[model samples]
Target: MEPVSEPSPDLAALADSVREIEHHVGEAGWDGPVRVFALVRTQEMLRTEPGLAARLDPSVLVSAREQPWHLTSVEQEELPVAPDLETLLAGLSWPSTVDGMAVSVERVVLPPAAEEAMPQDTDAALEYLLAHPERQDVRLVVGALRDGPSWCAVRSRANDTAEQVGQGPDLVPGLVAAVRSTLD
Candidate 1:
């Protein structure tokens, strides 16, 4: 088992930023395409792209003024194609202009008991899982910073309530690590 990550001064900011991205994706409903967004410091972004300020949320601008670090999300307009989401993420390397990134993707999750009964064939496995009574459709919004901090938020479609959403650093380690690598 992996150890829980130590919280940094920036942890709360990153977590809130991640949650914001997650909420943005949820606004579009489910079964949407995997979305990726670059998280950049609001101050730096404004400094580099001043014209974008008018398009940004006024509240984000207000918050940026009060905090030393405020991050804003910028959705990727065109993503490079890959056979799978993990492979696509593993291949990414972000520029310094980007302080971090967040990804929203839906996945099928099954209980531990269902693992042994899972079908071996790719097609059959998917069918079996989809047909499984315990199957859950979940959306995971994961984010990682260049400074080695990460956050994750998960909402199962079965009960996607504000109180039901799960948040943690290690909730999705593999994915957090993959995104973290890009920042590194």
Candidate 2:
């Protein structure tokens, strides 16, 4: 394996933003709908819409102005109906105003051994996954910029504590790619 290296400022910001998003989503507990967010430069957003300051917490505004690398995530309210997240993300396109995008999705993961007994039908497969002995419920929060780095954070239901969240650039590659696609 390659030696670990220090992360760049932009990448560090991405990681912070991704983990922040994960924490925000975790507050609502589990079994929630898929959520998507638009990541924008905190300073840019406040500059473009000064009135927004009235509704934001003072600490948030302070952080935005103090930390140039701080990112703001705006939850999307109206999402187009799609069968699955991959397809939904595949068709999404973000405006230039948005620096990046993030998504929170819950999935059931099973070990390699469980794959052999998976059912063929979609419904059956989902049931099998949910009922598996070694199943894990995970919430993946991934973000990517238009022409910059990407970040991912994974939190398992069994260990939903803030300190238990795992993070990496490529932890969830497929979701990271989808987020990047929206930026393009």
Q: How do the residues 1-184 of candidate 1 rate in per-residue lDDT, one tens digit apiece? A: 9998656646777898999998889999999999999988888888888999899779988988776568888899799999999888888889888888999999999999997899899999999999999999999999988885799999999998868899988799989888888787
Worst 10-residue lDDT window, candidate 1: 4-13
Clashes of 2: 0
Give the TM-score of each candidate: 0.93, 0.92
Q: How close is candidate 2 to the true structure, as a TM-score?
A: 0.92
Q: Give the per-residue lDDT of model 2 (tens digit) for 34-114.
A: 999998888888899989889888988888887787788899989999999989999789889999999999988888888
lDDT of 2 at 137: 92
Worst 10 residues of 2 by lDDT: 6-15
